[model samples]
Target: MFYLPALLISGVPLKEKIVLRKLTTLTMLLWLPLTAQAFCGFYVAKADTSLYNQASQVVIVRKEDKTVLSLMNDYQGDLKDFALVIPVPQVLQQGQIHIGDAKLFEHLDNFSAPRLVEYHDQDPCQPMVAYAMAPGSDAMTKYKSDRIADRKGLGVTVEAEYTVGEYDIVILSAKESDGLETWLTSNGYKIPPGASVALEPYIKQGLKFFVAKVNLAEQSKTQLKFLRPLQFAFESPKFMLPIRLGMINAKGPQELIVYALTEKGRVEANNYQTIKLPSNLDIPVFVKNEFSDFYKAMFDVQVNKHKLSAVFTEYFWNMGWCDPCAAEPLAPAELKQLGVFWLSPEQFSGAGLPVQITRMHLRYTADSFPEDLMFQETGDTQNFQGRYVLRHPWQGKPEQCEAAQTYFKQLHERHVQEAKTLAELTGWDLANIRQKMDLKDQSSTQTQDKQWWKSLW
Candidate 1:
C-alpha cells in the first residue's frame, strides 16, 4: 500500500479573525532590538495627540547585528492626533524605512494563532492499525537640521526628517531626558506625564529616539481604513525589545504578541521565563463552536496561573512547511515584505529559505515587567503548536457484538477521562461540561442498568 503521512491535511483558511479596526490604543509603551526582527518601542498616553491602549503586535527578523522590525498597533483614534515614540540603537536613514502591509500581520497572526483540530476514532471492535503523525509549522522618522539652533537650544538634535508613506518621521538625539521631553512637546508631540522619567534610561544608554506621526493629508491619500505597519531596519548588537516606555501612563496591563523569524532557530525571551503554551489536550467537542472564546478564556486562566509574570510561546516551527497547516508557510515574497533581508536571489534555490518562526505572547504592567524583553534564538528545532483535540467516538450500539460491548465500555471510560482533562485545562466544572457533552446521547452511558456480564454480550 502506498504510504502517506496520516497528519497530511490540506491547508485550511483561517476562520477566526481579530479585526484590526476593532482594536483601540489604551496607553501602551514598548521597545525591541535588532538581531532577527531587532528593535521595537512605543508609548501611549490619554491625551488626544497620543496613542493609548492594549494589545500590540510586532514582527522581528534578525540575524547577528542586522535586524528588520515591524511595529503595529490598533490605534483607532484620530490620525492627526496620533504619535509614536520608540528607541533605536543607531540613526535610521530614509532608505532604511518603509511602509509595510497590515494584511501581512493579520496573515501571520492567523497562521500562528492556536489551532483546534478533531479526529474520528475508528471502532475499536474492528481490527485497526495506527500510524505515526508528523507536524511542523518599522521605519524611522526623518529629523530636520536647518532648525539646528532651535534643536541645539533644547540639547536635542533632529538627525533626519522626511515623509515616509503617511508618517512624518524624526530621528532625535538628546543630551538629557528633560531636554528631549522639552523638544518633543515644543514640536507638537505631547510627551506624556512622567515621560522624562522613562526616557532618562534610554538616553543614558546613548540610544536615539524615533518619533513618527501620521500626516492627515497623506493618510487620506492612502485610501486605507487603518494605518499600514511601519518597518525599520538597522544593525545593532542588541537582541531585545524595550517595553518600559509603553508603561509610562498605561491605565492597566498591556498585551503584546511577537512573531520572531530567524534562519537559525526558535526565538524566546532570555531575561524573563519562556515556556510553551499548553497544547495537544483532548477537549470537549463543544469547543469547536467557540474556539475563540475557549482560547481566550484558557489563555486568561494561564496568565493568572502564572501570576502574569511569564512569556508563553504559542507556536514554534520551521518555516519550510506544516503537516496540518494553519495557513500555508508564508511565501518567500511575504517574508521579504516583512523585511527578511537575508533571502538573497541566489539563496532561493529549489529548497525554501531555512527560517524558523516563534510566536510569543505576554501581558505586562509596570510592576510585572520591569525591564525590556531580551531574546535569544535557541538551537532547539522541535516543532510545536498550541493544538487542542476533540475525538468523536464510534457510535455503534453495544448489543451488536462482544467487541461492540467492550468498545462501549471503553467509550464510557473515555468520556469520563476527557471531561477530567477539559476541567483541568480550563477550570470549567467537570460535571457541567459533562452535561454539555450530552452523555445522554450515548448508548454506553444509557446502559448503566445492564449487568456487567450482559455488557460483554
Candidate 2:
C-alpha cells in the first residue's frame, strides 16, 4: 500500500531573475510542417498515467540551474495519515513553495501520452493524398518546549515553516538518519519501518528534508475533494530525482511517469539505460477496441525485457505542435502554470513557448533502481512517440479492378505481419490475435478479407 512518494527535492532559485533567451531548433521548424502534410491518421486512444493504479506522476520544469518540481498525490487514505518527506539540496523558503493546479498535470499527461492512431487505407485505384494534422492540503502542529530542546539535542533544525495553500510545510536539516527518523516519528509523522535506511543516503549527502502534512481546516475552505499537487522552485546544478524514499513501504513495483519540460530537445536518465519504447508499428485494426489492454500488456513485456531497470521514453516532442497530436498542444499560459518560468508575458498572447517535453515511464523497485534518477538534456531534436498504427483495409471488392486484386493480395501479407507484430509486442497468443482478425492462418491471407464489399459500380 504505497502512498504518494517523496519523488522530488533539490535546487536553488535564481536570485537575479535571469531572463531565459528563447532558442528554437531551426531543423525542428523546417520538419514541423512536414508532419501535418505527411501522416494522415486520427488519434483514437491514449495510454495515460491513469492506466496504472499505483503510478505517481511528477512534472519537472528545468532550465540551467533553475527547477520547478511538482508532485501529484494519489493517496487514498485518511487525510491525516497522508505525509510527504523529501530531501532537498537546500532549504526551500516560503516564497519557493507553491500549490499547483491538478488540471495542468492532467493536461500534460494527456498531451504526451502514448497514442493509438488509425489511418484508413487509401483506395488502390486512386492516387494517395496528403492530409494534416491534429493537436492536497495538510496541517501541522508545533513542538512543545521540551520537544524543541530534544530536537536540538538530536541535531535536527527546522530551517523554515510555512502554510502554503492547504499544506503545512517544514524544512528540516538533520545530522543523522536515525535521529531524523526518530524526530519525525516523535513529531507525529508515521515513519515507515525501513525509512531510516532510505533516509541515510540523502542525509549523508547533506540534503535537507522537506516535509508536508494536510491542514484539514485550510483544505475545507477550498471545497475540493482531492488534494492538489505541491510544487517548489529552486536552483541547483544537479539534475536528478530522489525516488529511493518512495520504495520503502511500497507493496510491490511502483509506476512512475516523469513529464520533463526543458528548453532543449529531450531528457534521458544519465545513469540508466534510457531506451524508446517500441513505436510506430502497424497493428491489427482490432487493437482500436482494446488499446488499453494492449498497451498495458506491451508495457509489461518491456518491463521484463529490460529487467525493470531501464527508463522508457514514451514521447519526446516540441510543445508547439504534435505530429499526430494526442491532445492539442499546450497553450503558453498553461505552460507557465506548469512552471515554464522563462516564458515572457508577451509570449503568452502569441504563439507557444520554445519548450520541449520528454515523457519517461518506469516500473521500479528498490533493488532494481538503486540510485536516484539522474537526468541530462540532449540536443536531439528528432521527434519520437510510442504511436501504434491501425490501417483499416479498403472495403472495395477484390475483383473490382486489377489494382484491387493486388491490394487484397498484399493486404493478406500485411495482416499476417500485423498479427506477428502484435504477438511480439504484447506477448499475447498469436492464434488469439489471428482469431480476432478472422485470419485463418498466416499461410492463407486471401481467404480472410476484412470487410465484405460485394462490388463497386
Candidate 3:
C-alpha cells in the first residue's frame, strides 16, 4: 500500500491528501536481533507511525543553534500537483539544501516505535532460571529583472532559489501575509482559504519562506515510486516546528510524529505538556493478534483523556543501544545521513558519543493546538518507550502437580486483571475481553447466581 509522507508544509492542490493507509502489523514472526535477548522480554511487534492515517513525520537533529530539519512528504496524487510552503528562520543557500534517503526515516521509525514484547512461561514444576536475563543497551532561486521588480512591489523578495534533487525550491522573505499569499496564488501555488491568517504569525516573526514544488522532469529521472525526503541545515535559536501552516488547509485533526536527536538529552514541547503514553503494562496474550487495534484504541483513549492538547513521548533512549530493540540500533553512517553534525565517524561506534533520541506523537486540531510546536532540550536521559507485554500461560494442567495447581489458580486471577487492564486502557467492554480470553465473566456469573430475594429483611 502507498503510504503518505507526513512532512509537508502548505501542500497543494488543496484537496490532494497526504494520507496513510493501514498496514498489516507484523506480529510474533518478526525476528528480534540476537542483541535484543539481553532484555527480560523478547521483542514481538510494534505500533509504528504507519498505523495512523494522515500523519506527518519530522526529524530534527540539533546541537546548540545548528539544526538540520528533514521532512518526509506522504503526498498521494499527481506529481505535478505537489507543492510546499514552509517558514524558515533565514534563506537557505544551495549547499545547505539536500535530498535525503527515505530509509533514514524508516529506520528511525522502526527503532523508536512503541513496541510489543513477550515472555514465555516456564514450566511450573521447573525452576525459573531464565528470569535473570542481562540488560541490553533551501537555496534561493534566481529570478528575471521584471520578476524581481514585481515581487518587490508586493512586499516580497525572492532571496534565492535552487533545483535540488527533484525539487524546485524558492526562498522568500515577505513583508506582509496578504502580499505573500498573493505572490503564491499568482505563481500557481493554490493557496487555500484562510491562508493569510496562518501566514501572519511567521511574517510577523521576520521568518523567511522556503517554497518547493515537484520538478516532474527531474522526478521522472529518479524512477522512484515516492518522493525523496527534503533536508536543510541552518543555525537558529528557535527549536520549533511550524505546523500551523499545514493545518490551515487540513480537513481534520492531523497526526504528527517528531524524532528529535540531541546531544544533551531528550527534547520536549516547551509550550505544551509533554506526556508519556502508558507503557510496560501486562496485557492479555490474545492481544498478540490484534496489537495494531489495541494500540490505536489505546491512543484514541489517551487523546480524548488529554483533550488532544498534550504531546506524548512515545520513546526516548540513547542511540547506542535499546533494551529490547524494536529494530537494530542505527549504524554510524545512517546517523550522519540524518544530520547528526556533532558526531564524527570515529565517534559513531563509541558509547561515549552522546546521542539521545526522543520520539513524540501528537493528534491535534486547530482548536486544541493554537500555536505551532515549540521545543526545548532537557538533560534528562531517562530511557523510556511505549512498550507493552504479553506472557504466555503454561500449558500444563492444574492437576499435574501442587505447583501446577497453584500456577493455574494464580493465572486465572492474572487473566482477570489483565482483562480489566485492557478494558481500562482501550475502553473495550470488560465482558467482551473476558469472552475473547475464553474466561468466565465472574461479575455476570455472580449476578445471575445470586438470590433475587437476598435483600429481603
Tens-place lDDT digits, model 3, residues 70-182: 98745444566666778889889999999988877777877787776666676788634243222221011111000122345789889997899988888999999999888
lDDT of residue 234 for candidate 3 = 97
lDDT of 3: 0.73
Which is the leading candidate under TM-score?
A: 1
Against the unseen true structure, what C-alpha lDDT does each candidate score? 0.71, 0.71, 0.73
RMSD, candidate 3, Å: 14.1
**How many steric overlaps are in each model, in order?**
42, 14, 9
Q: Model 2 over residues 242-330: C-alpha lDDT tens digits?
A: 88777766656767788999997799999999999998788998987667677878888999999999999999988987655566678
Cα RMSD (Å) per model? 7.6, 14.8, 14.1
lDDT of 3 at 259: 92
List, residue by residue over 124-230, the lDDT tens digit for candidate 1. 66545333432322111211101213456777988888799998888988889999888877765666688899899999999998888777788889888677889
Give each model a TM-score.
Answer: 0.83, 0.82, 0.82
Against the true structure, whose lDDT is highest?
A: 3
- Cα deviation of 56 in candidate 2 (Å)? 0.8
Ten contiguous residues with the weakest lDDT in model 1 = 18-27
